[model samples]
Target: MRRVFMIGGAITKFGKHTERNLKSLAAEAISGALADADVAKEALQGVWVGNAAQGVLTGQESVRGQVVLRALGIGGIPVVNVENACASSATALYGAGALVALGEMDVALVVGMEKMYLDDRTRVLSAFSGCMDVEALPELTRNFANQQERVKKGMQRGGAKKKKSRERSIFMDFYASLALEHMEKYKSTQRQLAVIASKNHYHSTMNPLAQYQNSLTIEEVLEAPEVVWPFTTPMCSPIGDGAAAMVICSDEYARRIGARHSVEVAACMIASGEDRSKITESTLSRLAKKAYERAGVGPEDIDLAELHDATAFGELYSTEELGFCPLGEGGVFAEAGHSTLGGKLPINVSGGLESQGHPIGATGVRQLVELYWHLTGRAGRRQVQGAKVGLAQNNGGSIEGAEGALSVTILKA
Candidate 1:
């Protein structure tokens, strides 16, 4: 396989776009990326578009990629549409990278976009339910109830009262349950979770494209309204609309085109959660090991990361799963400033999904865009000092006890 390099990357400001449609947002990101790469539109050999809920939310289904690209006067090329919940765009990047690595295409364009801001807030929020197995929701709910009961018992025994949130999403509940388990098993504290949230909030202040630019202190994050126990509203990712795109090409093509400052794709691994009784290894852990091996680097070699922080717990949980720290020590790691800027490994310097806004399909690509800037020394205030290697983990959809899809990408300067 040929070596693949990310020649360019771009992202739209992540927030509610009342007037922009999916195609328009995608066009802006694509144009920016093409310009950044100094590549002409005609040079793109293939296109991959990642979008999760356009059909359910906007009534646009098959041929979504073709329709979107046609508006930009690009056609007759293979336009692949990818949908894997939040990891949609990252999956697209993996697909495009594969094509370049296989020499099937010297240059490819990958774009992830989503228009989630609708007038009907109910409809907009309800769409998240699609990420789960609707048919098995009843059983899932039963399991969740059991878990909640256990949590309540644990909290009571620990001389604490369980708190609940009015916001509805099985995902929040799932994360809360996981947080409770972490707290129980590892003695992690909610205050430590607050530290993570506050760190990301401050990081977003340096990211112009982030949805939330305001900084928050640890006290403020802890005082924020609860979305779920151990998770304040500030700790959770908000609904938003955005688009991100990247231009990837084979090393030969990049060198031929004189593309400077391109980041090499050291590794890109995609995997699904496995089914097993008393599973010992998590999907993220398994994939991270494969990614590290493929990249010829260890977690300690990574200078920065963009994790799938749908919530504060997501970052903490992923830190351990990605081998950045010992299992159950994620909270301690965060509290010790290990995950902060200027620390050992700065994760989510773009503010992460929690502060940058989670635009579903666009999130995965957005993470890559942030890392691209960091590796290239473009990240201004949030830049990690001398970042030479970066990793991104994007997971999407949830089923019983597992993520439906996950992608891990490692890049080197």
Candidate 2:
């Protein structure tokens, strides 16, 4: 198989891009990545764009990659569009990497863009729901609402009370339900969840490109609005917009057209959550194992990681699943600061999607951008010292509590 290397990667500051649409967002990120990699746009053989809800958000579906490519002034090259909810971007990355590995293309540009805040909250909420298995999610919302009512009652009784009107992301409600089960099975606590949130917040502060650049105290995270029992607003990802793009090329291509930043794609593995039940799927465990198998390195060999931490609970659960910590001990791991920078193996130095904001299709690629900086030692304040091996795990969709679509990538300098 041909070796694939990341020649360049970039993402727009991930938040509400009220100033841009999908095409403009794609152009900006692609332009930045191409410039960063020191490659001309014309050098790219093809482009792949990963997105979900754009059709609902803007009525532009097929040929999305072509439309965006043309708008960006890049000509004639083939463009592909992929969607797998939040995993859409990872899907794009996989396609691009496959192209290089197959020698079908020497260089490929993979981009992920999503615009969610175009309409009011209801419409945005509607679009968000559309990302799920449509049939199951509508029923899930009722279940979420019902559960939130119970949380509200507990709040009325002064158990984790906050004075604001509570809201729950449909995913969170599903997560909350799954998390509550995990808590019960594993004897987890809200404090443990807070530890995860606080850790990501602290790390995000070091990331200039992160959406939330300030640290949050454990107390502040714990005291935030309770969206679901055992989950505060601080623990959840926000609705947002942005774009991420990467230039993937062959090893020879990189040596011929060198750039200041070059991170080798040591291993790239894509897996799905099929056998793992929603209640049983350990997102970290399954995803991490596949990554290690492909990368020829175990979790302990990893110096740092950019994980799929869409919520504080996700950070906790994913850590356990990823083998950084034993099952049911992720909370203990977080409280010890093991996942923070300067710890045994720091994770989410980019603040994660929790603070970085999960812009659906853009999120997976953004995780790669974080991993790129760590591998190349470009993540200044958040740099993991002497880091040579880095891993990134991005999973989208939920089969119960586990991720439906999953990817793990190992990068090295």
Candidate 3:
């Protein structure tokens, strides 16, 4: 297989955009990406678009890519639509890179865009519920509620003010259960989770495209209104709308075109959660190992990272699973300030899903856009100095015992 490199990437401001449609948001990001790459629309050999909630929220089912691209006068090429819960765009990037690596195309574009904000909040949330097996949701709902109750009983503490129930996403409950289990088994504290959240909030203050850029303190995060027993409002990702796009090309194509600011696609590995009871290693751990091997690098070689912090717990959990820290020490890892800026290994420098906003399909690609900026020395205030290698971990949906889809992508300057 040939090598691939990302020439350019861009993202729209991530927040509530009820006035905008999918086509408009996509056009802005795609146009910016193409401009950044110094390539015209006609240069794209194929296109991959990722979205998750348009079908449920706006009745836009199939052919989402064609509809959005045609509006920009980009057509007459292979167009693929991808949806893998929150990993939609990351999965799309993997596909585009594979095609380039196999010589199927020289230049390709991958876009992840979503329109999630609606007047009816239930409709927006039902879209999230659709990520899982719809048929099993009946039983899953019961199990999820039971797990929440169990975690609450296990906590045996109270006094957090209750927040609006309508604002809670189903995934919040999932993360809460996982966080509580970690707390119970490893003796981690909610304060550690708050530290993660507070740090990301501060990071977003420097990210103009982030949804909520205001900083919060650990004490403030702890005192915020509770979504679930252990989770406060700021600990969870807010529903938002945005788009992100990337322009990738084969190394031969880049050299032929005299591409100057390209970053190597060292590795992009995507996988699904297997039966954990039968498997010895978890999905993310297995993927991270394969990615490091493919990139000829180890975890210590990473200069910075952008993890899928759907909730603060998601960041903490990923920190350990990705080998950034030892098992059961993610909470301690954050408490020690190892994951913050200018630390051992800065993480979620884009503010992550929690503070940057989680637009489902767009989030995975958005992480890459942030990494691309940092790797190319375009990230302004949040940039990691001399960042040569960056890693992104994005997971989506929920399965019997793990995430429905997970990906680990490593990039090098």
Evaluated against the true structure, the overall lDDT of model 2 is 0.81
Q: What ranking emerges by lDDT with the best candidate at the front?
A: 3, 1, 2
lDDT of 1 by residue, 286-391 (tens): 8999999999999989999999999999999999999999999998999999888888899888999998999999999899989998899988889887999999
Best by TM-score: 3
| Candidate 3 error regions (>4 Å) | 158-167
RMSD of each: 2.0, 2.3, 1.3
Better of 2 and 3 by lDDT: 3
Q: Return the TM-score for candidate 2, rounded to 2 decimals.
A: 0.93
- Which residue pairs collide in model 1, if any? none
| Angstrom error at residue 237, model 1 | 0.4
- State the lDDT of candidate 2 residue by residue for 1-413, as single tens digits: 89889988888888877877888788889999999899998798988889987787778888777888887688787788898878898888888898898899999998988888765677677666675677776676777678667755654345643655344457777778778767779988888888888888888787777778778899999888777677787788888888999999998888887667888887777776664543365555666787788877888898988887777877787777778878899888888878888899898888888888888889888888878877777778888888888888887876544567888888888
C-alpha displacement of 94 in model 2, angstroms?
A: 0.8
The candidate that wins on lDDT is 3
- Which structure is stronger by TM-score: 1 or 2? 1
What clash count does candidate 3 reach?
0
Candidate 1, superposed: residue stretches over 4 Å from native: 149-166, 276-278
TM-score of every model?
0.96, 0.93, 0.97
